[model samples]
Target: MEGYSEKQLGILLVAERLFADKGFHGTSVRDIAQEADVNIAMISYYFGSKDKLLEAVFRYRMTATKAFIQDLVDNDTMGPLEKIYSLIDRYVNKMLNEQNFQCIMNREQMNREQSPVKDLIWELKREMMGLMEPIVTRAQEEGTFYKDVDVVLLMSSLFGTIHQVVPAKSYIRSSPEFADMPDDEFVEYLKVRVSAHLKKMFKAILTHEF
Candidate 1:
């Protein structure tokens, strides 16, 4: 969002929504131009190409998140477990609040096409794993966490558990109990329920009783 101007941001936002709704290959540059009420030349001038624009979307969404997590991990005030919980909480909030981006990401992963955004996704994931490994290792060394824990497996457990809910909202909302609930309220429910569940799982994993 920082490097983009108002016009560029507007176009990128439209592209993100469209990309989420329709797969990247399905959404055309003309569609983005019409949706953003801009000419094709403007998009080309700003982002160079459709693939580049998608990359920009990834950069726009992920750069700040990576920086935030890095800061949280680097902070000396919070311990390893505190940082882990903070990371989990932040991730849940991101998935709920930024559903469009989440959808775009999920769709990209599901798509078998060679997308440039996939590289960014994998890079960020690797970076995240690298960032979390030290924290887990430190906790284990300090005897606060069990030795021989699989950091990647632990991360996947949290990621998989939270992500599985995004695609099931339709059936979940179709249920009688959730029928009357507003989307926002349901997402709030998700935040609370998921946060508690992950915390419990993380506690079990760290304590090595699982």
Candidate 2:
């Protein structure tokens, strides 16, 4: 816990929380310095500026994504479909657990034109599509999905499916039919719903090879 300098960890902790609670422009170096109990000058000394700190945060987020994707790509224990499921599970779990972080990510993406982390955002997206491509290719050859589907289109649909979940969660939870369910039950219900979509998409792609 004490290994890395407090200032470094401080930068990450403060940046993510602020970036999630308030948009980038709404957060400032002074705020982060105060929250992290470090000098404002230290932040600049370590990260150059608030903008650089924000970019560092996006880079940190990508590290987690990269690790899981790399493991799935390299692991021989699980087949292609299982690897895909594992990937989806991690992605969905993060969203379900961190609604604020999810919201922040989407906001940053929408405002990428002004974001300090725009390059990292684009790279994260392109890397995600690249990760899916090989799995989809392998699945098609293995008769797991369709051969005629467009890879990019299919990837877009996957992103769309996951992204839509957050916006609809409030609506679904407040509805009379779903309101009675417990929180865990509600998430499980969603898991099944998304899994069904994944299966349906998998089947569709099987018929065509997206």
- lDDT per residue for candidate 2 within 41-159, as digits (tens), equals 88888889888888777766667777678778778788777776677677767666666666678888788367777777788888877876787688778877667768787666666
Reference-based lDDT, residue 116, model 1: 80
- Provide the global lDDT of candidate 2 against the true structure: 0.76
Show where candidate 2 strays beyond 4 Å.
Answer: 1-7, 177-189, 207-210
How high is the lDDT of residue 76 in model 2? 78
lDDT tens per residue, model 1, 20-116: 8997999999999999999999999999999999999988988888888779767889987788888889999988888899889888887788888
Lowest summed lDDT window (length 10), candidate 1: 165-174
Q: In order, what lDDT does every prediction score?
A: 0.87, 0.76
Q: Which segments of candidate 1 are over 4 A away from where they belong?
A: none
Best by lDDT: 1
Per TM-score, the best of the predicted structures is 1
